[model samples]
Target: SIWCLKSKNVPTSGCTFYTRHFLCFSVDSPSRQDDEHKLIARYTTRLPLTLILHIINFDANKQKRELIAQLESKNREILAEIKRLRAEHDAVCQPSPEKGSTNPTLLAELRLLRQRKDELEQRMSSLQESRRELMVQLEGLMKLLKDEEQRQAVSSYPFLGNTETVGFSPY
Candidate 1:
């Protein structure tokens, strides 16, 4: 039989109740004769135990997905920026002997383009570093998620302890 502790103002009479964690309850009947009867009590706390864990898990999953998307977008943007920078650098590095025919304005424009190219290269390098850091964080979060899932799965099953051990290997 299942009983909810919050149904009454106080615990029901003749019931020995002990709270375990948040949701689980350990009940023992004072009378030995009641041993045959198994009573399961679920105490509703401010928050259900598993629900909170699941909510946290949901938030972590959402954060992980968002981070992954951000990382991918950043990676693409950084790649494009790097490619653009390289093209600009190549153009700047090319020897232009048109200095004789070029006007003063054209010379200033070329100088500004060269400076802009340098700035873009620096920006690209910084973005690449940020991407690397984000990737490391993503990997760590993924590992944490895997570990949490494994822990949940292990908790769902009863611990068989040493009884489940099979043949031993001598190594």
Candidate 2:
């Protein structure tokens, strides 16, 4: 009879049932072993399934908050810069007290300020688009996690009876 790891029928003492079909290999050198350890540590999920899911949810939330805060900060900085540029441009455009005409040097500086304002505006547009895309992606991921959690809840308790009223459903 085929035995599962959880089955009581399997012997407990040094029973190869858990490892029967698996092959064990060793690294050829200490460096290789260290590399293997690093790889495993990097890729392995050490927490239980539920905890892992919770951590993922928490991480998603944290990332969204951080993203918003970062974007807002950038937006504020860009706006302030644009405002400063506009003020400088206006000051430069004002008639010189003595010359009563736009100085060539002042005109050149105004051009540079306008160019910087345009660049900042373009950067703002790009940041807004990027934020929109990221929010959409995060929303999609949260939806998937919600669906998975619902599925898990249903599977974990068969007696729950899949129904919307009970807030649990099985697919």
Name the top TM-score candidate: 2
Whole-model lDDT values for every prediction: 0.65, 0.69
* RMSD each, Å: 38.1, 37.3
Which segments of candidate 2 are over 4 A away from where they belong? 1-93, 96-102, 161-171
Cα lDDT tens digits, model 1, 1-171, are: 333342323445444445432222334535423422322232234457798699999999999999999999999999999999999898767746784346687778879999999999999999999999999999999999998976666566546222337543221
Residue-by-residue lDDT tens digits, candidate 2, 1-171? 221121222224333555344222343444656655554554444436787788899999999999999999999999999999999898756666764444678668779999999999999999999999999999999999998998788778878754777775455
What C-alpha lDDT, on a 0 to 100 scale, does residue 43 get in candidate 2? 40
Which pairs clash (backbone N, Cα, C closer than 3 Å) in model 1? none
List, in order, the clash count of every candidate structure: 0, 0
Q: How far is candidate 2 from the true structure (C-alpha RMSD, Å)?
A: 37.3
